[model samples]
Target: MSDKKRRQRLVQWPRVALTTGGVVLAAAATTFVVRTGDAASITADSGATPTRTVVAIPGPRTSTPPPAPVTVTVPGLPVETPVRVTPPGAAAAPLAQVQVNSAEIVYTVAGNQRPDDPVTITYADEAGALRTVENVSLPWRLTVIPTVPVNYVTASSNGSQLNCWITDAHGATVAASTDNTISATCNR
Candidate 1:
């Protein structure tokens, strides 16, 4: 402890271990730039208390998404085609053949038929598939025909309280929700 004061404490212990390894490598590079740097802003003094980041600068990506005016639900019950779409060298919008036409039903029967009680007319189309009209006579006017727009029209009898109607061909009465009691359901 006397050879020049032990060589001046081994050169001041390597400058205090290289100044504590450069302050711990600058606090591990400021905690790796605050956990994987995007660095909107970061300041440090007393244990680093400077952070205000909200980096989400993304506003430029519409390669083709400004053309949306096509609403065509065709196959059944929805037919309104106006289709519009063009953005990417443009010019391509010509494909429409919406032909869905079929409507006729004058299934009327005005009461009182008891010749052994026989006046049955059960009809259901539009995929449910069932068409029938049996032993029709008296005050009846059957013509329940359709190509796809009539789901039902049933007229049963016990011989009293009978006033069924479903006319369309100027006899107008489009859909009164008669899914019961001398049933009739169209426009679906």
Candidate 2:
């Protein structure tokens, strides 16, 4: 067409392009805003409110009173000296006894052996019977040997007293007759 007509058409093309770009940008912004607002409302509704409910458990409402005490009397006792015996299911047995079989000795040395230096001895009583006796004493012989010997001797008896003697390898008396039922350790 003419020169003025071509110039007007070129100007109109730029305006149309700008209006199309503005409409596309507005549509994208509206979609983003609407989607973000819906997501925020869903999260707030789920988290901000909570439902409440009560649970009940059943049992006895009140406690019961204890049973009354019962009295008991033993025969052969005086009327004034009434013995109070506990009911069958009231209390349990308290005391117990254990029996042992044998005894053991543990010895320790500090330095070189000398006739005057005292020896140390330890005894563990494992005898079951209460009347068993364990004796500890040094030998009478003063002979110098490779190692100084400490003796542990045990005696058995039905009675409480245990009478025994401690002697050296030479048969000489280290300690005279001693009486003890329980286990003991002595150093000379």
Candidate 3:
């Protein structure tokens, strides 16, 4: 064949393929519309009247709008300043002049016990908290400041004749206990 005839045949093949592809796509789209209940159909017979069919067209699609952005604000704290006031007739007192009624508590444990005998000392500290000293030798002494109303000292020993004493800040014995076998307690 001639070159010009061969070229014309090649161009005609492309046109034919494009037309077939367009027809197939149109048919597929129509089938999808019928299957999804989006198409209208009508029927008629050779000797009967044509029938009109109505299809419910859907409304415009709508979606809920997204919520607005939220913002929160916190107020800043107010500034505070210390204030001092004096009595109408009395002068202002300095902070150092303020006195606290603190007392010294002396816990002493002594007896005719042997030097090798160990003892246990239990007492309340200034803040009314119990403290324990385990395996302590005889002639045990502990001094503390008493801030609570009640203070106590207890001693336990396996030695013979254990005596305990609790002295106040005035060098006076407030509580004393003596035990010949195991334990001695002093409370004030």
Q: Which candidate is the best by lDDT?
A: 3
TM-score per candidate, chains pooled: 0.19, 0.25, 0.43
Error of 1 at 115 (Å): 4.2
Candidate 2: clashing pairs of residues: 100-127, 100-128
TM-score: which candidate is best? Answer: 3
Would you give me the overall lDDT of model 3?
0.63
lDDT of 2 by residue, 50-141 (tens): 32332222111112322434444333233453334432122335576533222222221111233443333232222321222223233221
Output the worst ten-in-a-row residue range by lDDT, candidate 1.
53-62
Give the Å error, residue 151, model 2: 99
Instruction: Identify the superior model by TM-score, candidate 1 or candidate 2.
Output: 2
TM-score quality measure for candidate 3 = 0.43
On lDDT, the stronger of 1 and 3 is 3
Residue pair clashes in candidate 1 = none
Task: State the lDDT of candidate 3 residue by residue for 95-129, as single tens digits.
Answer: 67654334776777766666666788898988989
Query: Candidate order by TM-score, highest to lowest?
Result: 3, 2, 1
How many backbone clashes does every candidate have?
A: 0, 2, 0
Off by over 4 Å in 1: 1-110, 125-128, 133-148, 151-164, 167-172, 175-188
Q: Global CA lDDT of candidate 2, please?
A: 0.38
TM-score of 1: 0.19
Output candidate 1 Cα RMSD. Answer: 26.1
Error of 3 at 39 (Å): 99
Sorted on lDDT, highest at the top, how do the candidates line up?
3, 1, 2
Candidate 3 Cα errors over 4 Å, as ranges: 1-102
